[model samples]
Structures are given as structure tokens and as C-alpha cells.
Target chain A: MMKTSKIPILKLYNNLLISIQWELDDKTAMQFQEDLLKKIHETGATGVVIDLTSVDVIDSFIAKILGDCVNMSKLMGATVVLTGIQPAVAITLIELGIELEDIHTALDLEKGLELLKELED
Target chain B: MSLKISGIVEFIRMHRDEIMKDWIDRFNKADAQSISAESDQIDQAIAAEYVNILIEWSKNKEDEFSRKIHEFSKRIVQLDWPMDKIAQCLHTFEKILFAKLLEKQIPGDPLELLSEIEKVTSPVNREVFLQYTSSYERTINLQKMALQELSAPLIPVFDSITVMPLIGTIDTDRAKRIMENLLKGVVKYRSEVVLIDITGVPVVDTMVAHHIIQAAEAVRLVGAKSLLVGIRPEIAQTIVNLGIDLSQITTKNTLQKGIEAALEMTNRKIVSMGERR
Candidate 1:
């Protein structure tokens, strides 16, 4: 079940807006990282935005997965954008000591969609 | 054919106990009041009357079978069954015996006896079930206990051995762990001083204070002084309540101040004079 990673990619011009609906727990995060990386490499998308509205908790391992996904996308020539990060999530992220300096997070999904539209040009 | 009563009496005596024991068990245990200490006299009186009736009914004891049936009926009134099984056997025998004698006037209920048997057997089954559940609960409890024991962490020890004790809610388990880790840190580093910064620790009770004291003692044994940093006002209040003495140990409010104290102990102070302040 954890092998199935939800990386729904939509291409608009040069950019790809991916909505990750799958639960990115420790077990499934690696698969997601691999899947997103492979998709970005294959499609040659200039920019990517990930929607995280459904996700409730992001532990150390998942955070590390996110870190790797961002770094790998950089190598593949794309900017990774995160969306829908709640206040509680921010507190948990800080307590867990996950360095989210490199990845860009928007307030809501609408901002993420707008950013994707802007990045396409 | 000449009928002899003595031959009948002997045969009746042999099977008398087997038949009578069942009736008596059901009679007494069928209701709580039947066998209670308060109703003993009443039960004896009823039994005596039953014995007389049985004797009167079997007055014509010429046949061995008839005489034996009489004695069996008398024994049942006395509650002489060893177990429910023996009682059951007697009830079955009574049924057959009454049928054979063409005594339809006598009322014996096989259904009621069967119900009684089920009631008697149910407690044994319940006892077995209780035992199984208790064992299951104990196993689950033991697994949780084992998990807790295994998950107690090993704190990281540095080369310089700077113990940053963020001490709030120093429970017994944590206290013991802190003590052990601090001592381990002291010996492992072979350093002169350990900077224990309790900046985030809000409360320190007697037990928690004692743990810190023990850790300090262990550090001193390894020829190291533990400089505890960040004495919060709340912690100070708690310590005063317990009447503990912190006169010997060095304490400071900030990590920088603690560092300065350790430096002064070694007579190595950083002379950073501000330019034209």
C-alpha cells in the first residue's frame, strides 16, 4: 500500500504543478521522493508546487524525505514549492528541528496555484 | 411362589444410597433458604416426614426391587450425593424406578434436574474463561513494560562533555537517567568542567534536586566540577521550600556567566575591554 505514491502532475507551459495526496509517512516518503524525482526528470518540468493540505503530521523521516525531494529537484533544474502549512505544523517542524530554509511554502493552495502559473512564464 | 421380605431388604439396602442421594441434593440446593443455618431445624423436620412417607409407601416389602426403591427414596431426602454427577445418576434411576413400579402418582422432573446440572457446570466453565483472560491481560501488560524498558534512551556524550540539562519535570526515571548520563559524560570526556545548563527547567523538587546533587557528586569523583547554569526564579522558590543547601556548588543565570565562572576557577579570564565605551 505504501508503494503507491500520489504524484499527480499537470503540465502548464514549462512548469508542472503536482498535488501529492498520498500520506507521506516514514514508510511511504521514500517512494514519493523517488516517484517525484523520476517524474520531474522524465517530463523536464521547469517548476513544481506540492500541496500538503491533507497531511496532518510530518516526522523526522518524512521531513528528511522532503529535504531530499527539494535537493533532487534542484539537481533536476526545478524549484520545489510547498502549500497549506498550518501553525501547529510549523511548531512541530521547529520542535523536530527540520530545517525548511531551502523549500518555499505558501499560505494556502490558491497561492501555490498562482505561484505555479507565474513560474510557467 | 413364596415371597421373602429379607431377600428384598438386602437388595434394597445395596442400591438405596445410589438413588436417594440425587433427590436430596436437588431438594437442598434448589433454593438458598433450604440449606441455610437458620432453616436447619425446618429441613430436618421435613426430611423426617419424607422418611416416614417413604417407609409407609414401601410397607409391602415382599419383593426385593420394591424394598430397595423405598430405601433409595429415603436417602434422597437426606442430601447424601457426593457430586452433581452422582445426583444426576440417582435422578435418572428414580425416573426408571417410578415407571417400573407403575407409580404415576409420584412426580419427578427430568427437565428441572437437567437445568440444575447446567447451572452446576457453568461455574467451572466461567472459571476457565476468567483464567484465560487474566493470562492475556498479564501478557499484554508485560509486553508494554518490556517496551518501556527497551525505549529508555542513551543520551549523547560529547568530547568536551557539555551537559545541557533542560530540567523541567525531572521524574524518577528521567532523574536516574540524567544522573547516569552525567556520570558517563564526566568519565568519557576526561574534562575538568561540565556545563549543565537548566535554562528551560522551571521546577526542581527534592527528588530532582537530589538527582542533580548525585550527578554533581559523581562528576566530582571524576575530578570535575559541574557548573549548573540558569537558576530560574520558580526553581529557586522550590529549592527554598525543600531547605536544600547549594553553598558548595557554583551556579549562574546564563551559560555565558557559567562559562565565565569555570574560566575564573582555572584563572583563565577573557579580557575583552570595549574600545572607548
Candidate 2:
């Protein structure tokens, strides 16, 4: 089932790793949330790196959904790493009262992927 | 008989002289009434003069007290300056982000304004706000670090007697916030009876049920009672399976019934006082 999301999944190293390039807009946010959860379960992915640099607005609801996505993915024995969330976006999420401390983010998608690989190791 | 009359008049002179001396001494002291009788014109004049002086002195005393109060307030405002700063951190981040966005959407020297703010605010605040702007994780962590992040409201909105109905999912984090919000609201409103309608809540698990109870307890801590409404069958089953006691909190089947219970608890009859008219 195409679980209601347009986010691309890059299967690298012969399906050893998967990266979700989540180009989240205002409308596609909820879809990303549901689809990501489904993919995490279906792939039985070891680690998932979410590239969110394209997402401009980090509203409270989106921030919460991100955290919940992390929690849900962790429950399925997969680690979720977020990347490309600009420094400015992080600050806004903080102001919105969304605690992103436990949710790791990196400057670029590559670094985030590297970090996720490290977690896998 | 002549000598007796002369002696009697002499005794009267001595007593009058002594009384006059005493009144004069008292009149020299505090400006209050001399505590002497105003039987004659002279005594009446002295009493009136004392009353007039005390009137002027009383006005002076009042002015002095007013000045002292003003000074005390100024000192207090200056003394607890950090408390205000800390409280601002607890709340103003919302406005801060909004302002920054507005600045982005407008044309202005946000840097100059930020500098001005830095001058007025403490180093800690500047650091926190700066981090809130520059580093996302640090900002979020700083905000989350605050255990009691809620600020004391400058103005009391709802009297402790006001009611606020909460609806939706109640997670542990939300429960805490709800507890804080309810307590803050009850205190703000000075509300005696709180009607928490749960009709809008989609579902309630063990944690959710516990949170509702915690929120009720928090309300009571702030001197208010609560009536929880609209516990769905699924939620009830969850609660029973979890074996949590909500008996400490009063619950009703509907929002209407909860409001009625609140009225009853507050000893407010359901019929409006204007009904008699």
C-alpha cells in the first residue's frame, strides 16, 4: 500500500540502509507522519534519516508529529535520525514548546546519515 | 461668714490655676484634643485650636504615608528585577518568534532592536534567546529543562470562580500541562467549581485516565473542585483494566451533567438568579 506520502525513500548499499527525503510542505505533513511510520515497520529498517531541510515551517503540530514518529519508530526497534533542519527552524520549534532535545538533527543529510550509520554499528 | 466666703473663693482660684496649667501642658504636646472640657469660651477656643492643628497634622501624616508607599513600590520593582526577567523567559519565546517572523516579513533593523533588548536583559536571557535563534536543539533543550516553566501571570484573568472545559487526548506531558493550566486558571479565576467536559476526548488509556485524575488533584490543590465529563466506554474499560481509582474525582456522563454537578458542588442552584424576574 502506498501509505499516503510523497516522500522518497533511497535504498542504498543493496537495501542495507534507507533514507527518507521528506520534502514536507504545510499540507503534506500528516501524510509524511503516517507513511514514515508504515515504511519503518515494513522495511524493518535498521536506521532512517529524515532530510527536513526543505521543510520551512515547523509548527507545534508538526514538531509533535516528528517526536511521535521518533517514539513510534523506536518502538519498532529502528532508530530515526533527523537532518537538514536549519538552525533557525530548530529555534522556532523550541519557541513553539516542542522539545527536540532527544531528537537529533544535523547540519546536512550526509552527516545525519553518517550518524545514523554510527548508531547502527 | 466673710472670712469663710473669702476662703472659698481663694480655693476656687487655686483649683482653676492648676487645671489651666495642665491643659496648657497637654496643648503644647500632641495636636490632638487637649482632653479638657469646653465649658467656657477659653476652653472652647483651646479645644477648637487643637482640633484644627490635629487636622493639619493628620493630612501631613497621610501625605508622608503615601510617599512611603510610592517609594516602597519603586524599590520592590527594582529589587525583584531578575524575577521579571526569569518570568519573561518562561513565556515570551512565543512573542519573540512571532516578532522575528514579522521582522522577516517586514523591513527593519532587528539587530539594533536585539542589541537594545540585550542591554536591558541579563546575560543569561540574551544567551537563551540567542540560542533560541541560532541553535535549534540547544533552544529546545533549554526550554524543556525548565521543570516549572509556567510564569506567574501579571494580571489575574478568570477569577478563581471561573470554569474552563478541556477536551482531547490527555498524554502524560499534556496531563502535566493540563494540570498546570487548570491550576493556573482556577487560581486566576478564583474558581470554586471546575467543570472539565471530556466529550471531545477521542480516547483515554491508563495514562490518560491517570492524567485526568492528576489534573483534578491539581485543581483541588489550588482550592477548586472538578467534575470530569464524558468518559467513553473504551476509556472506562481501559481504566478498569488498568485498575486505577478515579473515585477521588467526581465524574459525570455528559458535559451537561458535569456542569450541573459543578453547580451543585459550588452550592449554586441550576436556576439562574434572574429567573425570579
Candidate 3:
């Protein structure tokens, strides 16, 4: 396994906080998706906050994977909130026709935690 | 070539007064209203100085001639003289000078004389016209910048709520500005809801609708809800007629309702003081 393929997912109370600080390749993103699902199942986390504050570029493929990850997390009884989406990345994703419409978004991790809490209630 | 040019210049010097008197006469006849006492004085001085400048230019003093012409053009443009007036004035001077030379029967090819006159005078005319156009373009750009600054203003009405009142036709450029201002204000104000009040927007075409939708989407991505307000009756009809999909965006008919919706989203409401003593 490539060293870069594994991104650490930290558990915080009933929520999983994953901050992606670097660019993600296909394998790493796929690995992240599986690891997040497994973690969610094992911890029985009710909320997930995926922070993309430091991740600058998100192409259509990654946007699609994110949207799918949010959907999959929902299916497994976990509410996923995407946080810290940069302004340029948002514009790029929208330009690429990936609205990520069904996902919840917050300005930062604290707000993302609040949103996740709201969804759980 | 030097001898011939000097001869021409000497001949012009001898009849400078007569040529200038006739040139002013022709100019006043063409545009009599422009002949004010101050301007007439300036024109007369310029007419005499122009002859001296050309004489120097004929001596191959090209640098002096170019600098002098540039200064003259800047002055003339500041006086707001129309380009045609300047051209006609120069043409009048040329006609009078040529008539004088012709009457003197100077032994030379008239074509060569004409070409020599063109070489010196064309630069002056070109410089004046160029200066006029550049000054005019500068004024227009300044006004455009002022108008653009006045067009979009984002006002944070309450905590976590900002209002941007757009008052004009929504073009692609203005829409882009609106989006930028909205996003920046949202981040700055930590606004959870942004109300874009377009009551003054005169039209809602397909392109305009698309820009608005895109702005709303961007606002959403930045974690702020974009609420479009002040959709007039005609604007509503146009959006529907154009089949523009604004279903994803939350819109209200008036800013009041939009503010209510925004306040509601941010978990706030205005309460009236009930009969305070």
C-alpha cells in the first residue's frame, strides 16, 4: 500500500472529524471513503465533519466522490457535514457542474459540528 | 534639399503676418462663436509660434519640433478645441502659405513643396487628435469606475445577515461583482444569510437569471444562504417565460419578506414594543 493512500480519521465524541490538509489522488480518496465508512460503523458515530480548508483544488472526480461519500454516510445512519470549503474550490466545483446539493456545508469545523448536531436532533 | 527648405522658411517668415491674418479670418468665418477675446489672443500667439516651430523643424531640428508639438497639443486639448477646428485652422494656414509661395513664383517642383508641407504639418495634426482622444477616453473610464463603485453596495443589516441592494440592469460583469461582494461580505460579517434585493433591477433575462443562480450557488458553497428578493411582476413572468430554473434558490417578492425569511433562518425575529408607557 502506498503511504499517501491512508488519511487519518479522528473520532470526536459522537462525530468523526477528518481534516484533509493535502491534495487527494484517486486511490487515496477511495481509501478515505472506505476508512470513513468503517470508522463510522465501528464508532457508531452519528455525525461526520470533513474539513477541506487546506485542500485547494477539487476536480469533478473528487467532488463526485465527496457527494457519494456524504450519501453513503447518510445511508449508514451517519449525518455528514462538509466544512471549510474554500471560495475558489466552491466556484470551481460549481463551474464543473457539481452542486453537491444534497450535502450539508458549514464555514468551519465548529459550525460543521453545530450543523451535524442539529441534523442528529 | 536643405537650401530649398530654408528658402521656403524665409519666404514664410517674410509674409507671416499676412498669412496669419488671413488664417484667422478664415477660422472666424468658419466658427465665429469660438472666437472669444481670450481664445483669439491664444490662437494668434499659437499661429505665429506655429510658423516659427515649422521653420525650426525644416532645419532638421526634429526633437525640438516634436516636444513643441506635444506641448501645443496638450494645451489645445485642455482648451477643449474640437479636432476639426484645429485641422481646418492648419489647412487655412497651409492654403495661405501656398498661395503666397505660388504668387512669388519660387522655382521648384510644386509636388515637392506640397510633400514638404505635409511632412511638417501632419505630425502636429496627428499629435493634437491623439491627445484629444486619449483625454476623452480617460474621462469616460473615470466615470465608468465611479458608476461601478456606486452600483453594488453590501450592507450588513443584522448579526449574521447582510443585504445587498442591486439597483440597475444585471449584466455579466456587474453580476460577477455582486457575487464577489456578497461572498466577501458574508465571510467578513460572518453572515449566515444574505439577501440580494434586486428591486431596482429593470430586467430579468435568461443570462441575468443564470448569473443570479450561479451567485446563489456560490453563496451556498461558502456556507451562507443566498435569498433573492424584489422580483417584480414582470420579472417573475419573464423568468417563467424564459424557463430559467430558479427552483434551487429561495426568492421572495419583496425585501421585507426576504428579511423575514433570512431572520427566520438565523433564528431571530423583530418584536414590537407593546404599548410602552
Candidate 4:
């Protein structure tokens, strides 16, 4: 049996916050995607902020999953904001040719919430 | 053969002063302007050192000969002596030595005597040339480092606004550096907008434009907006003519205008105060 740990997602008011504190393997990233959508459904959240401050290396597959999660959450009526992307990761993603063009981004969780609030208004 | 070789060395040692005079006179005549600015005493001292190293080599003092040659070459390099002039100086000394040996009619084959003279002089020539090129390479490497340091600099001008002024041709290496600095500066300064000023860039070909676009995209990914500023008229013409799409990035004609736009994005403005009464 393969051991897989679930990334914790916290709910604050109508917003769901997920801070990835470690490197995410493909399995965990997919599991987080599903869990996030289900949590948004259960809590009826209108916004999501995914903080990737602690996550260092991201391959193309993980980037694609993150982009997909954003689009999927948008279809379910909750806006998603990716926050705290490291400079190295950003350069890597750009080099990998993944722009994540439609996804909203913020510098940190605080700004991510502000962006979410601005989107709501 | 051994006696003949020692005889040639003995012959060179016996007429050392004559060889020195002839070598110095020939060197000064060949490139008078190169050494004219320097005091004649320093020039004579360097020439004497050269002759002494050659004498030591002919005497079979290999250790002292190498040490003296190394120090002499370094000094010559520091004095900014041209390599060709040094080569000519060594050639003149060899010629003078051969002439003196032939005039005395030393008991040896002319070819053997000439080859012996060449053996003593050629090593010094090679060492000096090696030192000259290595010193030049050191200087070029230092200047390259200095240029890299000046290539990318991010200045945080106002709250939530930073400025990176690029001042040279954007090669792929420099472009990579600019992108890294722009992103790190944005995150460190918590800047919402960054203005990349390229006023000093001389040319903007397709490759440069592509690098700039990639940098701007990476900045966006790091959650900061990048504004391309300082677009001179020619750069604008090239950018448009190349059919590069810079529509995604906000651009301004000057850094001043870009700063204003950055202020607005951060929900601020510069209000001018009237003159004091």
C-alpha cells in the first residue's frame, strides 16, 4: 500500500485557504484538487486562495493540475487565487511553457484575500 | 657536442655587455614611441634584467633562470610593454649573439651554434607571450564581471512599485538575470507593479523582444505586473515591425509615465503642492 498524505484545506468565512507546506507528488496534487472542489461544495465557499510559499519545485504535470483546479473551481462558482509563488518556481513554470494565463495570482495570502474581496465587489 | 655547447654559452657570457647594448639599441630604434614616455633608466633596467636572465639560462642555472624570467615577464606586462616589441627585443638579442659567435669563428658547425642560441632565447619568448595573454585575459574577465553587475538592478521607487533599468543588449544570459532580479525584487518589496526601463538598450531585435515578453510573463506568474518603459522611437518601430505582441504587457513611452501608471494601479497619486506664499 502506498502512503499518501492529504494536504489540509482551511475554511475562513466564505473563503477556502490551502497552504501547500511540502513538495506535492502527482497523487497528492490530484487528491488535493478533488478534495478542494468537494470542500468548496460542502462549505458553499465563494473564493479559494492556494498558497504555494513552501512548495519549491513544480514540474509541468503539477502546473497543469493547478491550472485545471482553477478552471474547475471557477465552473463551480468559486473564484481561485494562487498566492506566494516563489521566484524559482515561476521561472521554472515559464520555462516549462505553462503560463497559467487565466488564473488569478497574488503575492501572499493577505493579498490573495484582498484580490478575492475585490473580485466579489 | 657538450664542449661545443659550453663553448657557445661561454662565448655569450664573455660578450654579455655587447649583446645588451646591441639589443637595447635595436629595441629603441624599432619602437621608439612605445618606450619614449617612460624614463630611460627604467627601460635600461628592464633590458638589463632580460640579458641577465638569458645569461643565467646559458650558465645552466635553470631554477634561477625560470624564477627571473617569470618575474621579468610579469614586470614587463605591468609596464604595458607590447608583446610584439618584446618578441623583437628577444630576436635582436639572438641575432647579436649569433653575429658575435660567427665573428670570433667559434670551433663549431654554424648550424649547431645557431640552434644553441635559439634554445636559450626561445623559452624567454614563450614565457613572456604566455604571461602577456594571461594578464589580458584576467582584465577581460574582470570587466565582464563588472558588466554583469551593472546589467540588472531593481530599485523600489515607491510603495508597491519597483523599477528595473536595463542598460545593455539583452542576451539570453542577461535576460535570465533580469527576470530573476525582477521577480525577487517584486516579492521582497511586495511590489504590485514593476517598471522595466530599457532606455539605454541600443537594439531590440526579435530575440530581445522575445526575452522581454518572457520576463514579463514570469513576473505576472510571481503575482506582480511588469510595465515596459523607455521605448525610444526606433525601438518602438522595431518592436512593431517584428510583429511581436506586447499587448499583454502595459508599456509607456518613458519611465516617468510608467511611474505614474504604477501609482494609479497602487491607488495613489503624486499631488503637486503650490509654491509657498
Q: What is candidate 4's lDDT per residue for A1-121, written digit by digit as tens?
A: 6667899999999999999999999999999999999999999999999999998999999999999999999999999999999999999999989999978899999999999999999
Model 4 lDDT tens row, B25-130: 7767876775665546777898778777766775657787788788888998998866776677777878888988889887778888899877767788788999
Ranking by lDDT: 4, 3, 1, 2
User: TM-score of model 4 relative to the true fold?
Assistant: 0.92
In order of TM-score, best first, we have 4, 3, 1, 2
TM-scores (chain A) of the candidates: 0.82, 0.78, 0.95, 0.98
The deviation in Å at residue B63 for candidate 2 is: 63
**Model 2, stretches more than 4 Å misplaced?**
A1-121, B1-161, B272-277
i-RMS, every candidate?
Answer: 20.2, 17.3, 1.3, 0.6
Query: Clashes in candidate 2: how many?
Result: 10
Q: Which of the two candidates, 2 or 3, achieves a greater lDDT against the reference? A: 3
Model 4 bad stretches (over 4 Å): B1-8, B32-40, B58-65, B107-114, B274-277
Shift in Å, residue B9, candidate 4: 3.6
Q: Please state how well chain A of candidate 3 matches the true chain A, as a TM-score.
A: 0.95
DockQ of each: 0.01, 0.01, 0.65, 0.84
Q: Which predicted model would earn the best DockQ?
A: 4
Best-matching candidate per lDDT: 4
- Residues A6-52, candidate 3, lDDT per residue (tens digit)? 88999999999999989988888988999999999999998999999
Tell how far residue B83 is off in model 4, in angstroms: 1.9
Query: By lDDT, is 1 or 3 better?
Result: 3
The fnat scores of all predictions, in order, read 0.00, 0.00, 0.48, 0.80
